[model samples]
Target: MKLVVGLGNPDREYRDTYHNIGFNAVDILAARLDAPAFAYDKKSNAELADVALGGKVLLCKPQTYMNLSGDSVGYLSRYYKIDMRDIIVLYDDIDIAKGVVRARLDGSAGTHNGMRDIVSKLGGTGFARVRIGTGFKPNYMSLADYVLSHFSSGERDLLKAACEAACDFTEKWIKGEDWQELTVTVAR
Candidate 1:
């Protein structure tokens, strides 16, 4: 079985925020794949949707917020006995330009607190990752405030396209296709 996890806060207020891009990506993928509605699981503290993508795949949206995302990921991974190599995480990256989607097979978490926590819990960085860019934070705003802010109307379309591209990238990963060097950048 393969696991695809999206990292974000669980609050309604975070629905369209920059930090919630991971959740947005998974939602789009689920819809495109005709996956069933996500059901909340108390033990995992996440919303899960099982979909068949080349095989049995579990799409997860962790509800432990950004900083503590590792709790849900670790529990679910251990419970499912999923290999670290078969796991993939999707999340937002402020360092890249907005509307860009990038994939990496294995690496350190960098500056994302959610990814950092997940890495810490998993005790390894062998899993894959897909990052949706939310653009760099402005010099005037704090990182926390910027990440929590919602995307502008103009950027919304770009984000939607980016999410779709992320879904394609994820599909490639699930199918064991070449996805390591793929980078998708939406037109402005």
Candidate 2:
């Protein structure tokens, strides 16, 4: 089984924040797949849906909040008996340029506490991941405050488009498209 985990805070207040782009991307994927709406899974402490993405696919949004996201991801991984390599995590990255999406097999957590927690819980950094760029936090703005800020009306359009492009790349990956031939760049 394939697992895709989206990292973000669960509270309603964080729904549209830049840091919650991971959640937004997951929602877009679910909508595109025409899967049932995500429902809270108490056992997993996450919002979840199982859809057919060329096969069985488990989509999850950990409700444990961002920093402690590993708690939920670890639970689902152990419970489902899924191999670490089959798991794909989606999260925002401030270091990457705005309107870009990157995919990698494995990497360090960088400055993302959520990813750091996941690496700690899972005992390593072997899982696949997609890092959606939210752009660097402006010099005048603190990283935490900027990540929690809501996107502007104009920026919303760009983010929405980015989500779609990211979803397309994910779908292609799922369908066995050659990874080396894949290219997804959204900068509008």
Candidate 3:
């Protein structure tokens, strides 16, 4: 089974925030697949859903919070006996411009605490990740507050487009498309 984990805080207040873009992307995928409703999984600290696409089974997780994402991912990954290579993490990145999506087979956590925790628990950075840019905030604002805040109207539109592109990239990945081609196609 392939696992697609979307990292974000779980709370009504975070519903439309930039940090929740990962969760939004997962929701888009689930919707496109006509997947069943998500059920709360205490062990994973996430909302879990299973969907079949192009003959592959996908396990989706919207982790409870950014910092604690690793706990959920680690539990589910081990439970399903899935390799880190079969897992893909989706999250927001402030370093890139809005409406952009970048994919990497493996890398350091960068500035994302969520990715850091996942690497710490997984024992390495051998998993794939899709990053959706949310644009950077001013130095005066706290990172936590900036990510948790709602996007401006313009940003929201750009975010929506990026999420759609992310879904397309995911579909290509599932089809065994080359990463270079997938990245180039999605970047457009």
Candidate 4:
């Protein structure tokens, strides 16, 4: 079985924040599949849903918040006996442009604290990743404030489109498509 993890904080206030793009993307994907709605799992501390592609795939949205995301991830992964290689994490990337997504088979956490904790807890970086771009941080803004802030009305369209693209990217990925063959970045 493959696991797709969408990293995000859980709460109504965080619903539309740039940091919650992961959750947004996962919700899109789940809807596309008409998969069961996400339900909170006490053991995983995450919202869980299952969809079938090549096999049963678990869609996870970590509810431990962004920084402590590893706690939920580690628990689920261990419980599922999922291999590191079969895990895919989707989250926001500040360094890339808003319409772009960077895919990789393995890598460092970079600047995402959630990813950092995930890598640290998992003890490896062999998992796949789909970094949904949130654009670069402005010189005048603090990273925390920026990520937690809502997008402009104009940017909302871009984000919604990006979320769709991310779902497509994820579906193709879990269906065994070649990573390099997928659209690395899709821009309007």
Ordered list by lDDT, greatest first: 1, 4, 2, 3
lDDT (Cα, tens digit) per residue for candidate 4, span 143-173: 9999998888888888888888888878878
- Backbone collision tally, model 1: 0
Model with the higher TM-score, candidate 1 or 4: 1
Model 1 agreement with the true structure over 7-79: per-residue lDDT tens digits: 8899999989999999999999899889999999999999999988788999999999999999999998899
Q: How many residue pairs collide in each prediction?
A: 0, 0, 0, 0
Candidate 1: residue 155 lDDT (0-100): 92
The whole-model lDDT of each prediction reads 0.93, 0.86, 0.81, 0.89
Lowest-lDDT window of 10 residues in candidate 4?
A: 179-188
lDDT of candidate model 2 versus the reference: 0.86
User: How would you encode candidate 2's per-residue C-alpha lDDT over 99-146 as one tens digit per residue?
Assistant: 888887778999999999999998898887788888999999999999
Give the best candidate by TM-score.
1
3 or 4: which has the higher lDDT? Answer: 4
In Å, residue 121's CA in model 2 sits off its true spot by: 1.1
Best by lDDT: 1
Residue runs of model 4 more than 4 Å from their true location after superposition: 181-183
